[model samples]
Target: MKPAVLSGVHFITGDVACAEGALAAGCRFFGAYPITPATEIAEHIAGRLPEVGGTFIQMEDEIAAIASILGASSAGVKSMTATSGPGFSLMMENIGLAACTEIPCVIVDVQRAGPSTGLPTQGAQGDMMQARWGSHGDYKIIALSPISPQEIFYQTILAFNLSETYRVPVLIMTDEIIGHLSERVVIPDESEIKLVSRPRAKGRKDRFLPFEPGPNGVAPMAIAGEGYNIHVTGLTHNEKGYPDMTVECQKQMMARLTGKIQNNLDDIIKTEGYMLDDAEIIIISYGVSARTCHTAVDEARSQGIKAGLFRLITVWPFPEDQICRLAERAKALITVEINLGQIHLEVERCVKDKVPTYLVGHVGGTIITPERVIETIKEAT
Candidate 1:
């Protein structure tokens, strides 16, 4: 029998690393429909899962794919699904359902350029805003950007831990570049890796309230067949998990749904800063674009430009306060992203006219090179 962790060094694409990462994190169920740039993950995990005593299913489509994961997660299994642009769009409605019902699951979106199937094979980070707002209504979700195959592995594990801890869906915001790029990923022993399972409900099953939050503002989850009165729904619910459509129920439910994530931002968000202490110019980016930012920052510094790099590991919460602090002291801020200007607007919003903000924006189908970023730095000055 194959080991669950698949411990050791290996050369692999980011997609395979992601599949291995999910297994290492104790993910037992994967439900996805094959989609371009993201289908390899489902194919890889499908074979590996059976060896590890897990389940993998290819549903009718992306909608059913995500719906299956939500149902699987409700039964107290760690669940995930992967897709590209069009499929990701199809999963939005059910993604919102996961949020409303506080189901712990992960969605891997290896984004391709698109408003509607713009590019299938080419890479793009065009899904940044959609990851946060694609699902309707007001909900707080976590999204992580991995710079490489190695980091995507770790980020995948982190996604599961956070979902279980917060009882909310987490997103791995990857792109086709990193998703298909080959790299060396070191898989350590299972003993060294950290894993988190959902907070299980205890005490008498008769009085169990599935939606009632514990001390951390996140409710303990009751499995579907665990004899608990689990009443999961997408509608406004009271602590008893029953539909409560009144004003008080709406407000109370909304508060916890958003607050559980907002209140715990410190734990959920992760970012990296380099050469920032005395920076007059700040270049912000994430995912594969961030790989170029690293070189761009070095090139700027070599040219005697007081530039620094602020790479976002977690994108959804937006890192508003951190960007604001940097903006206050920096002479300028530049956002590098493949989208025309999704994250750039957020950076400009956080700057609040404090600094002259600029965007090194790209439409799709390519990467913004370090030289292009340096050119923007010269222009910003």
Candidate 2:
């Protein structure tokens, strides 16, 4: 067999491709606790890293898993951790730490039914909001959703680039269905992809402030053991890593931490539209559920219904502006997900007054289907 081609590239499963993506993204450190649906990510990385002279550790728990990855990232290694919903919840505190300490790392959350282990092997999109605000505080995060295995591969690499460029933790917000689904994925050559490394302090090492804003608000991070003697902490710290509680210092730190992402959001956020120009009804979804919605919209279009599909590749820093534009012309918006009404609320918020938003959701172990979504769109249109 030669290889499967997509967009003229080869194919692979979302999970396996994710590991390959991480390796290609220059992730040298991986610390993760095994969990259902997402275990393949760790397994693949564990096997692949040794060949690339990288390191992979199966930590005792998700908390330690995330903490270790953050620590590695602080040491100036591109790092990652993979987990499902239950494990993802356990890593919240350290995730907050990564945010405050400005550690660049990637966290892959292959979501399953949640709220205390609702379903282990099943798929769910329940963690959509959690990815945005699971960790405490006001720090912003960037999250990417993959609807297919091929997308998973590409998005994982993009996740690392965004994290490094923004000096923040990036989340690959995948789901059980897509994680396990076997599909073809092409590995792009490095030259064809944009790779962003953390900016380095150019001069005056003695005067270097670890957290000081650079040209884009993201500070260049020097490795802890490096001659720069960089100090990192979770406390609200000033440029010198000393805890600063003054109103001005706090404001400046928060603004820079958030502004890095907000200011460059247009470059980070991505969405795909299908048959949108002629559609009266829009199907909005992300992650694994998006595939179903895409199929639904295609079927609806064939049935003479003006239905379009909007797939959210960047789930966080949500596509409010683009969504608002769609809402203006859309008669109705239908959101489909494996979890009950998680992303549906977001769609409602985006298109509230302009159009009615309908949710086609499933709970526990069930997966939403294209047929059901098409029916909902038909009724709405």
Best by TM-score: 1
Question: Pairing residues by index, what is the TM-score of model 2?
Answer: 0.95
Instruction: List, residue by residue over 1-381, the lDDT tens digit for candidate 1.
Output: 689898899999999999999999999999989999999999999999999889999999999999999999998889999999999999999999999999999999999988897999999999999999998889988999999999999999999999999999999999999999999999999999989988899999888888889998998888887788678888889999999889999999999999998988898889999898998889999999989988998999999998988999999888998998998899999999999999999998898998898899788899889999999998877
Off by over 4 Å in 1: none
Give residue 310's lDDT in candidate 1 (0 to 100): 96
- Assess every candidate by TM-score: 0.99, 0.95
The lDDT values for all models are 0.93, 0.84
lDDT of 2 by residue, 1-381 (tens): 211111246555688888888887788899978999899999988977777777899999999999899888877789999999999999889888888888889999998887787788888888888888999989888999988888887888899999998888899988888888887677766667667788766677788888888888888888877778777778788889888879888888888888988898788899998888888998888877777877887788788898888889998988889899999988988888777787777788888678788989877476787889977987897
Error of 2 at 165 (Å): 0.5
Top candidate (lDDT): 1
**Candidate 2 Cα outliers beyond 4 Å, as residue runs:** 1-11
TM-score of 1: 0.99
